[model samples]
Target: MSPSLFTSLDVKSGGGTAVFSFLILLLLKMAFDTFGYKMGMNPWPGVFGWYCNPAYRLFDFLLGYTGFLVLEKTDLKVSSWKISVIQCVTLVFYFAACHLFDKQWVPAPFILLTLVLIFAFTLPGGIFNAIFGNRVLTHLGNISFELYIVHQVNINLMNHTLLKWTGNNHLLVFFMLLVISWLMAEFFSLNPIKRFVTKSIYKSKIFI
Candidate 1:
């Protein structure tokens, strides 16, 4: 999670190569899944059935590499509005692609479109960073891992409790979850107890 990890020489070299390999593997897995379903054959069986699909391994591999690449390549500083817009667009495209091409394998056209969108959205930030430097981006990057860890637990608890009281108001639940997750992330990031625990566990290499 440390920003330093992203820019390490090892990551830039091996990590990038690993990511590209994983993407290729993922395409292979999708092919397998499609073939299996079409032929009415259950190719994978037993416990760990899900992992039998090559897709899962490819995904994990991609995440490992792409995450490092993103950290290394992008300025972490971005306005919330810009971040939200990118997220919304990405989600829309992902769902649209899924719905439109459910039976088809990952369409090359959609993949190319996605890559174009990513580069386009990133250009403004790249230009700004060239002129203004990356101080804001680096600071913003620090909070990301902490936010990821805290948000899910905070949201899940708030969602369940709110549902019991409010009779399934999705909007209210969503907003509350967002607000509470942010607050919890902020709190945990600063809390002495949490810091102590995190450092202790990390030092021991016991949590992973």
Candidate 2:
């Protein structure tokens, strides 16, 4: 989305408009993804994809817009240590549920539950920084965008190599996959694919 679009939407204004946009954009993105996945044929790239991608990104923008909305609506300092503690407790469940489930669809209440908890725990001065804050997590978070894209490729390579090294120790292979994926994520973050996005956004007069 363009900066102007966000400004025009006043997505931070925190009321009915924000709520409606947030919900609608997310639904649209999900619908689009499902449609794409079901098409079976290779998706048309280039101009066709360029035009179609914003339906997905709007959902991403609304996610951030939601945090600001929550702050405005609640008017409570999320920094309260008590709130952060509560948030972290819920975060433990959120992580557990994510790790445990196949996640075709998360239960609706849990969706609301986890978002609020994550907001409280992760905001500045929140307990997440105090308890889980460290170099490893910070670096992983920094490169998370690249990590999502690059980790699987690196993991596949490592899986084969580790098979030879450990004679098919799946436990050790999984551990090494995590470590090597992080390293590869770091590498890609430093030398990124952002050039294409940068050029496209600038030429198209779109926002970051």
Model 2 residue pairs with clashes = none
Cα RMSD to native, each candidate? 8.7, 6.3
lDDT of 2: 0.58
- Top of the candidates by lDDT: 2
Model 1 has an lDDT value of 0.53
CA lDDT scores, all candidates in order: 0.53, 0.58
Error of 2 at 171 (Å): 3.1
For every model shown, what is its TM-score relative to the native structure?
A: 0.47, 0.55
- At residue 92, what lDDT does model 2 achieve? 82
